[model samples]
Target: MLKQIGNYLKSKWSVRLMTIFYLIAGFNHFINPDFYLPLIPPFFNSHEKINVLSGITEIVLGIGILFYPSRKYASYGIMIMLLAFIPSHVYFIQINSCIDGGLCVPEWAGWFRLVIIHPALLLWAWEAGKSSS
Candidate 1:
């Protein structure tokens, strides 16, 4: 039920799992830079540098979340990071193509990410912060 799921979200293990998810995602930013490059909106002056910095930021936030005392702060950082990526999501919808091509999905998926998935992630980070705090 929803109540049970809510309770689970507040649990410490959930925090740890989410922490690991961030860590892996951050690492992937470096491991698979090519996948991210095309997604960068053309307005940005330095796509490569921005991508690396974002990866580093994620890595640090992941480390922060791994520790109990820093979890709340890290959760907030995660929420902010998610917010920061909103424009890229918008760009994806505008472009209507996969970042590097080959895995193209319908434009609806792009809109879905912005309208639904992004908010869900924000809520997830908010819950994580509240519970960890």
Candidate 2:
């Protein structure tokens, strides 16, 4: 099963699908800024600007990962971006996984995102970097 997963990740279609995923996700930051705004921790000022910047970064890196030459570095950039988001995830957990007037979910669900989904995304990005290289 692990080998099958690896083979799937290494496929060109997987990379393309990842490309589309990030592109849409990045644009969603703009289309639904309110959704992300509440998720931003209070320590960060100018939430609007931060949201724009994050969106732009995601869009740029998403585009960059589509090309063979830039795939590795772009993937690295994505990894860094994900790392930068750790604080927000921690804050979510700290706040009992509920954002007032924002996202509200079970605490365990938040932990699952931080512990499981996040790492899975990292692995996917890493494999994207290696695929077709």
Candidate 3:
């Protein structure tokens, strides 16, 4: 079972899943603005506009990744986007893993996400862009 799962992850289906995941997550930024707004750091200007721009970029890149011609570029874009998001994650940690009126999690979980999950997410995006087939 583990080997099968591993094999599947290396297949094109993994990329498809990543694309769909981003698409839904991106759309959620618009559908539920409240969850995302608090994530933007206080130092950034025009929180609402930044949120909108982020959503649009995610949607565009997510869609762009599906095509053979654009997959590499889109993956790179996703990596860049993830890099751009480091500050937000850091801000989440600074706020003690609990945003006032927004997402709240165990303190360690925030660090775990920043240290572990973020890199894994980047790797996933990188893998999705590769022509492994």
Candidate 4:
């Protein structure tokens, strides 16, 4: 099972799709900061800085994964980043923070973001690792 999973992830298309996903998500940080800003933890103090920092991290990770020499490092970085953000998702759930548009986003949306998207991000990173190998 592990070997099959490894082989499946090694496919070029998997790598390409993961790369595109990372690029899109990273760019979204800059293009739609308001959407994500509400999700940031209160400890960050300044939302703007956190927004910019997230964008920068995303952009860097996206670019790094595409570069041959940095691909492994980038994949690991992305994996770590995804894990790090899990707490913010927890915070969002606890506060029931309304999404940026003022309408209350469904409770499931938070869970989806935390459970689904987060793992997908990790898988994308894993795909990057396979490609780099």
Candidate 5:
């Protein structure tokens, strides 16, 4: 099963799909800034600098992942970024804060993020590396 999954990810469609996902996510960082604002850690709210930095990072990382030479690094960077954001998710759940003025993001959302999204991201990164190699 693992080998089959690996073989499937080696296809061009998989790479393109992963790239598209990053592109959408990166673009949405700007298009839907408010949606992500609540995910920022409170400690960084001393001023608005953190928000700008986060947006810039997302855009850069997204672009980096699209380029063949930098895709692997970008994948690693994205994985790191996702892991780093886990605390913010935890904080959101603990404080019962609404995500983008909507109802609180369900507790399971965080778990899904950690278990599903993060691992998928890591696999995407591995695929990126395989393509580059």
Candidate 6:
């Protein structure tokens, strides 16, 4: 069973799954604006516009990744997007609470996301991009 799972991970299906995941996430940005608006730091102007733009970008990249010719470009875009989000994650930690009065977790949970989950997410994108066949 492990070998089968490993084989799937090594296949293009993994990339497709990643793309789908992002597409859904991006779509949610529009579907649930309130959820994302709180995530934007106060320093940035036009939070709503920024959220819209990011959502559109994610949709574009996610769709671009599905095509063979654009796969590499989309993967690169995804990587860049992920990297760009680091500051937001930091901001989340700095605030030490859920943005927009959402559910608040302990500071350690925020730190764990920054220190662990974020890197793992980046690595997942990197590996998918690098291993594209």
Clashes of 3: 0
lDDT of each: 0.82, 0.89, 0.87, 0.76, 0.69, 0.78
Would you estimate the TM-scores of all the predictions? Answer: 0.89, 0.93, 0.90, 0.80, 0.77, 0.84
Model 3 weakest lDDT span, ten residues long: 2-11
lDDT over C-alpha atoms for residue 93 of model 1: 86
* Per-residue lDDT over 9-125 for candidate 2, one digit per residue giving the tens place of the 0 to 100 score: 768888888889889989999999998887888999999998998999999998988899999998999899999888889888999998778889999999999999999889888
**Per-residue lDDT over 37-59 for candidate 4, one digit per residue giving the tens place of the 0 to 100 score:** 87888877888887787777877
RMSD after CA superposition, every candidate: 1.9, 1.4, 2.4, 2.4, 2.6, 2.9
| Candidate of highest TM-score | 2
Candidate 6 residues 1-133, lDDT tens each?
Answer: 8556545544688878877988998999899998888878889999999899889988998887777777777778888988888777888888875655685788888889889987766666655555546
| CA RMSD (A), model 2 | 1.4
Pairs that clash in candidate 4: none
Best by lDDT: 2
* lDDT, residue 14, model 1: 79
Clashing pairs in model 3? none
- Using TM-score as the yardstick, the better of models 2 and 6 is 2
| Candidate 2 local distance difference test against the native | 0.89
lDDT of model 3 at position 75: 88
Which segments of candidate 3 are over 4 A away from where they belong?
Answer: 1-10
The regions of model 6 sitting more than 4 angstroms off are 1-10
RMSD of 3: 2.4
After superposition, which runs of candidate 1 have C-alpha atoms over 4 Å from their true positions?
A: 1-3, 100-103
lDDT of 1 by residue, 21-82 (tens): 88888898899998787888999889999899889988998788777788789889999999
